[model samples]
Target: MNFKKIIVSAVAIAAFAGFTGAASAAIREVNEWGASAQFLYWSAQAPNYLQNIGCYNGGWTKTGPTSKYQVSVGTCANGDTFIFRVGEKSSFDGPLSVMGSTTDPNRGSIDPQEGCGDANPRQRLMTDETTCSGASCTARKCVDITVGASDVEGESFTQVSHGMKYGPSTATNNVWIDRAFSAIDTSSLANTRKLVVPFGEFVNNTVTKNGVTIDNLTRHQVVQIYSGQAWYWQDFGGDYTSLPITRCFRHAGSGTHATLDKTVMHSPWGGALLTDESLVDPLTWFNDSSSDLMKCINTIDGAIGYADADQIQKVGAGQTYPNVSAVKYNGVMPTRATIANGEYDNHWAVQNCYYRPTDAEAAAVCNAVKNVPSSKAGFWATTCEMTYMKDKDWTYPVYVGATCEAGPSCSDGLDNDFDGSADAADTDCQ
Candidate 1:
């Protein structure tokens, strides 16, 4: 069977069903009601949000085969469409416009020619070539949302604050933060930067190693390994008694590296670097994508690396990295529950939805995109988090403030422990 023809047929069928009233009146939204929204998000869990959009209430349908990274297209009840472009959290440097110029159109652009050379359209989108030129880009007809690479969360607000500080852009930036980009300083940003909405939580910067047994590590031990203080597996209680621990890092521009730097190596506020630079030998360190990191862990015994917890889980589930698994930090495994509850101390940045705050047209489009029916509260990805951790159903609301709290009231006679502490608060609450 021709896979290309099959994928084309499948997409056409889905779209036709969407418009043919077979999808329900709620899904037949008029174009005037709202414009489509596009999002360029960089988070390991970005696909969870995209897949959830398709499975949201059956009003939308996901057409492509499932993959760890895929562009998703969904039509909502009000005829409003949603397009998602996602990438590795580490590669997300800034908005797509930050790189593309007329002189170098492909600078920030996702070229199907290069990224999708051998893959079919559907496979291309799923495999990170989510963008294309002209009519070939069928994820969404209108360019309402666009995103950039690596971890959008890893970017400090300092990067985008300047552009929004003075005033709104003269033209449409055309980028929407689906999962909001994490900002280092929310207070430093202008109030008008309202469009940079926060949503969802993630456990990023997880340490992983091969299936070899090792003692549960503390943040201190993890730091020791990366900072070059710990040389042998014996230093960290690994099975490889004589092997020297190999260090692997993501690229500098990677959000994964940024989050690991801030959460594991840097000071609390990330104002200063924290690693012992002199000890870290660049020659011995490996730097590449998470997939590449997985390969490194598989091939190089006593190797250790970091990536998003969700990415690790997805890879493990796919059995793609059979030799690798997530390493426990402080004796607590990085699970959906630990990440959601903030128990996993080395949590990554909150995913943010970045958009042009002052651009009314863009805002309207984005608002419509996110505010689809049955999407105001949760998505499939969040639901997966609940299911994966065997917790109650959850929602992926727009990011507002710290989901993790502390202080006196945190120890109050309420549900401080998140265990339904109706009367007596758990000691852990304190």
Candidate 2:
């Protein structure tokens, strides 16, 4: 007999003997639930968190025929699955569960609101450029080719969720909000509740053209750079031989932009150092895409910019940007410990989940969605801003929020919220 026949016969014999092998021996099957959601570009780390919770059997699979944003699919063990798409938070003005084709007039094209011109470009796969078919750039459409009902295999996965880094108030004023109007008060419109959790911080980096790097910068120096007060590389130090300090920033609708402005640029008296002339400088570039922003920094000499620390880890780790380095703020490097302990005073961006109040199906999944960090033991004590963070000993932080003892014996001054008075002396004990 052939070796193939002999192998098949051996496998058949094992099956007949009721032998159960490793999990990889057979295909894993699932039949529980599925969902689809659209979220902000900064939260690109979200898929990592989802995959860690076993929501996906193996890992996330990237799929999308459009360049406007990113799309990833996760297949669960119960036959349930989910799809995630990345876009500016402002563009998502409706329910997280809205299902439509890539060709639909509203959902089909990237509009001018996202800093692209008003030509209404079609979505490319991974590039940020719009599609134009005609000679005059008149015929433009998104190029996404994924088509099918939101449901898979004729069965429906009932839960849908939407995520963003900013709150509804900020989302309303952004020109990219794609709803008929930018009102986020869903109390009258649908079943939605604004869920919030402490998110991650952003870190600004001072990169050189090639030879050298600036290790740290004071808040005042950063303000001067963005405000046009510091225009040349020599202004900070004679660290590099490059001239013309290049400043790059995210476009106006970005959540990172808002956070930077609030934390780094704002004055003590409710003012800003960046003037109109500085913001509108021809030399500066307002990039709308994070990848594009990184590319800009990598390609430009003497370039300086800010991005989510987690985002930088995702791309800046082993990719391009060989000449660039992250700046330590006030002698402290950006890390989960620094941010958690409030050592790094800037870049505390948040993660929010919004769903319609009437959508009970979406609401059902809120626990798994909101408790992403705490769900995994020692994953994130009270944060959901990154894929994962370990302490100095490389272990998960101990979570003491709900699990903290609330009664008389539990009161300890060292533990927060326990009231300094220990034992029965603390009101918490009573």
Candidate 3:
């Protein structure tokens, strides 16, 4: 598979975000579409922060499979309306658009809009005065999109693109809130499968459940699925009728996707690395937004992917994410208790705001997001609340405090929780 084509598709899909066909008049855009921020990490949390700080429709949803996953448009307090596009583009577009460079040389200018030849009209154009065209394109007035997002951070996307350390954000232009990433799947049943590692190739073929044999989706199995080693549910003992596993993935530049690369494929705690996300394009399915990915997974059986867990729990217009569910990794689930304590730490992300410093409106929008503490929004991965800490992604965590016994103390033969039974016998330990 051609790697460059995958990036081109990411930019194109972002160009055609879900809002272009929205049915809500109340949330109809008024900006006449000035140059939108090329990158936005958490579109789900943008509307509220923009609304509280002042984008009017900040909370309005442009319909999608679920209102919760739809794009948000609002007239902010500053009276400027900005639309934060949903899905994977936010992470993909941020670094390239802000720095004005492209990884693809054939696409165009040395720094031309992500090697796509010309600047993407919607990404860099800040004002309605001129469109991006002509022999030499004008520099875009970077629009800042400050959002309190969950799951993958725009900075992590930058880290993958630049190969930088994951602790501090490589893209300083992007501000952040907090978030936690989740490894997801097509069915809730997948969660209950007894976690087991495959010792050899083709071992999944005979594995089963209920005194019968079925393949289990261990972390190692997930790495295989994404890396093209496992092609169908039958390949791993899953009972799903579908053949040829559908790898639902966010586009090349998505922070969620990048985090996926680190959390599973190239992870420090891993087997069978996914060398290049685009390398497995033949067996993969891509979506630009988190919502779209949900739809993709829900529509297809035997499909697996990852996304911001916060959005997975959200409901829209009496609708919830149906058929799609997050599964446990190595017997541990991605919950606040497990994630913060280092028991379920893979793909835990830190979010940040991304915008052009020159654009005062963008800065104001980001400032609005900063005012809302991550704690208020629920499960935004506040470091102070965590019992374990780590310096970079793909590295196991170190116990930072003793507040939670779920990790280590759960096994100490004594009564760690004073309830009588200790070790594996205690409910708290369980």
Candidate 4:
């Protein structure tokens, strides 16, 4: 929540470097870059966490935005600012699933060797630093941020989606989350929901035409639409609109995209998805962050995508996404109650936090991120506040910390009386 801008004049590198060597050469400040700005912000602005991370200002400044990654900076007592967080790339998680190209390929579009031969070959990473060299970079500009600007290191964002979900947030999908690495498994903050651009384009799948009902997409319908099986507005049930469906997806390496891949397109480990965008050859659009995707969704008709439930709906009516109608998935809405109860699972994921320096400090930061107040964090359910847990992304919900009864007082294997038995065996559930 601390987006207080810190105005720093850029200083010459030589002088600052000399001062750094004499004053703070041994310090290597915390730098994190990964998914979800909201998730990362929880840690960067955590009460009393700045000092623990070698930061002293206890304040934060958000870089505009990124195609893949963005930074939220923090300051230390010595006037030095560090890259507190950046969105993760999942280290090329999941399969790259690109098809062979012809005269109209994206790889050659950039530099023939740079961009992804599949999407945009010139794709880049989401990490940026101060405008100049680190020693005195702050002097020239305390914090220089360029959102959506091409960091020579980033891959191209211009790519057509094939309804193929990018990467899931799981360690298995995002291997960096494996035990070998120091990571925190912060459970989901909120579920994700369906989004259509050109505001109010959906207007409810049942705009009511000729006494016929056009319903919002079901899990099956979602897959059908994304894979090109259902190509038009009439494909679902009614002749609501003549517009052909344009599948919108997060650029590769997006956790939300991965969640849709697992929970909806391929539910219950149901089946394989169409990997080749060419097979569907459906019209597609891609975005970097929640805001970017929302912007894309609102401006383009027949465009449908997904983002965090909170991020997608937190908008004030008519303030943003003014025309978009609420579309449902399988007749159930993605409410906190529904997501917590397992009715809507497509948009939620464990908010895992990873750190490189060491595990102890990593645990502390991760704990703070997981513990951010739901009110302050916006739409995210606290890790243990939910009533159920799932074995997989969209699997059956299992009652966790059930004390023979569902009550407010007991949870997550809590044992008030020192009894070894906590869940179902406890008197509450009994």
Candidate 5:
């Protein structure tokens, strides 16, 4: 059947009053059995209340024999016009009665007399019928259901607009952190006198230390030395070891690199030495290559490198080669506790930051991140942390469950877990 548009309009008066007229007056049939329902009306006076009851509402409670089905009414009204259509389904075998009303019945018409010429337009109300019979009797039950006008076009327009406004974008960068240290032996490095590597000045010689801790001094010193500013280890208060200090760093384009650059090379030092100019190409500094930072640390006796805390633990576990030693920065060891409490402060150089693809995508990703399992998201993922560092009032960096306060001396470099040698050398406690 061709689609028809239904419009209902009404006139308004200055005086506000309840409808004072016959409750039911206009009755019009717009269709027949096994057909659709359509109706329209326009009036000088509008109805105070309009009710459109479907066959499901106990169609036609007339005093007559129960039939298989019945017809119902459809309404379309604005301020003045009130139009209605009543129809019966093929399953319906009973008499149908249609009713309509307006606040001023005398002024409104349900089925316009001028619109539906001489023959009243029969409204075909849709109905679904199913037959059921018990030992006592057989009967057919009629269910009144109508297919109304389509508002899909309008709804589609709204949906498209909303999607365009909040759709995901392709501009954001994504980085993955590997858990290399989980397999390593971190406890063995406890209390060992291994060389410490500092990321920046924030990790100075004055910081506290625990066995196997990547102290603040070590982290800061590494940046200084790598950038060619601190030519010797003694420049930073460490023992003036004659051996050339080895430097380890995260690969280029890594979030770890970003954190290191921001906290150590950039912010604390005002980007004086390790500026973008010196480290012109991040890929040259760090990347997925084994011959890269990780390989350099593993092969070189005095080399150091920065990776995810998980990766550090993995190296200790013997899952991969014992790559590098955990350096002490400013004397304070980089234990999980120091990171959590902001005491060691060196760990603060790193962050697991997340951004939404778009404003709408943000809501969805944020929700998914919250629901994702920690095991699946990896060690450094922000599942445990609630505050986003970029957000307002966010005071602390997110902490993984790494801690050195379990009675392990931070300076010994011995694997307190009893798996192997000092610091980065331990295959279990990285």
Candidate 6:
């Protein structure tokens, strides 16, 4: 049989087998909250098919829909079987027990918010309704709590959460966050500092520096830069001896910086450097500019810096300096696979968060903030004060590599495809 036919037949066989199980008295009720509320109902007749039948709080719209109520069919199924494509807070409601047969998948109904359903105090403001004038703002419509920088440690990363708590504040215009990497030439500086490069560039640089196989390094080293222990090149079994370590970090208020801190330093140093004042808190070992962080790593001996992989590539290609080296963590080198998998745990986290201001003005201001076009743009806008660092990189570990076949993907970075592969090559490798 042809590939298409074979695939279809396999699907049919699986479907048939799935339905052959004894009729279940359970009905799966999946509810999604944030930006919109979506519910899916499943019974035996539709054991494999979930019908999108109800909605509330927000409805579908042309420009962008928001309402106190809405419902759509065929949007989700089996409760936790879909990802929130839009960046919004959400939760699954139920897997209530019901009598269901393959001929009739509908069994029973349950409240969408019955269990620990998803709910965010923050709601995103409609784009057209917000405006920012100076630091103050106003929102045209009602909204959640206004999101402000909290004095609490780690609050700099809580913009969306706070915005939802105090939104609809005001309509205000602010800077847009952009994602781009800056170049640094260590040769130009009198003192060379160690820079921490992202996992990808670190791996390539490590290969170039030691002539070792990149794959030999454990995935952990590629993503995270451990403090102190992995400081010297010799630590990784490399030949370089007198490498002066220079710490590289994103701009003071960049989300990338926040993510790195959260992943690498949140445990031992939880509130130490992650306060509202120092948004992008590096390890406190080295100081370098976000633009030249990578270049510093490339040109300086014993240099280390952290940067987005894409930005590192750009700097390595365009700059006049020599390429930098990345250190390996636990023997695994950083690569697309390691990053996709949690094996290379680093500072980055899943980028998903939302907020709405209760104050009309704040809501309006929150709405005006748009997603950054690139890492470079995000970095620049945060530096320019057009946007706050909090909203730029709000991420959760949910939906890391989840697929429709299983429950919603959680942030642990597993292969939900059940294809025997864990992350990179899995069918659910998004």
For all predicted structures, in order, the TM-scores are 0.48, 0.49, 0.49, 0.55, 0.34, 0.34
Residue 15, model 1: Cα distance from true site in angstroms: 24
Tell me each candidate's RMSD, in Å, in order: 14.4, 15.9, 16.5, 13.0, 29.5, 19.2
lDDT of 3 at 235: 64
Please identify model 4 stretches exceeding 4 Å from their true place: 2-28, 37-40, 43-48, 51-215, 267-281, 314-317, 345-347, 356-358, 373-378, 402-430
Off by over 4 Å in 3: 1-88, 101-216, 238-243, 267-282, 314-321, 355-378, 401-430
Q: What ranges in model 2 sit over 4 Å off?
A: 1-62, 67-211, 237-242, 267-282, 314-318, 370-381, 384-430
Q: lDDT values of the candidates?
A: 0.35, 0.37, 0.40, 0.40, 0.27, 0.29
Q: Write the per-residue lDDT of candidate 1 for residues 1-430, one digit (tens) a residue.
A: 1000001123334444434454434321111100011112222123333333342232222322222233434554445454444332233423332222233222232333223322221122232224443323324222222322223332342111001110111325322221222332222211111111111111112332353355366677666666666777666544345566666544343445555655556543323322211223321333334555555565555566766554443444356666565656777656545544445564344333333343332223223221111221111112222211211011123323332222113324555325556424443222
Error (Å) of candidate 1 at residue 188 is 11
lDDT of 3 by residue, 365-421 (tens): 433332112222223343444667655444556777743233224445776444566
Q: Write the per-residue lDDT of candidate 6 for residues 1-430, one digit (tens) a residue.
A: 0000001123333433432342542222222222111111101111121211111113221111322222222322222221111112221000111111112121111122211212321222222222423332232222222222111112333211111111111225211222222211112111111111123334224333344423333434423343433544445555544343334443332344544545544544433232211112222222212333454455444445555543433544445434654445555444434443444545333222122222322222222222122222212111111111222222323323322222113334665445666655553233
lDDT value for model 6:
0.29
How many residue pairs clash in each candidate at the backbone level? 27, 20, 30, 44, 112, 107
lDDT of 2 by residue, 102-184 (tens): 33333322333332222322222221112222221222223321111110111111111112211111335433321121212
User: How far off is residue 132 in model 6, in Å?
Assistant: 19
Please rank every candidate by lDDT, starting with the best.
Answer: 3, 4, 2, 1, 6, 5
- Tell me the deviation in Å of residue 292 in model 4: 3.7
Stretches off by above 4 angstroms in model 1 are: 1-91, 96-212, 236-240, 267-283, 312-318, 359-430
Kindly provide the TM-score of model 6 when superposed on the true structure, using C-alpha atoms. 0.34
Measured by TM-score, how close is model 3 to the native structure? Answer: 0.49
Encode model 5's per-residue lDDT on 295-323: one tens digit a residue: 54555443445654434443433635453
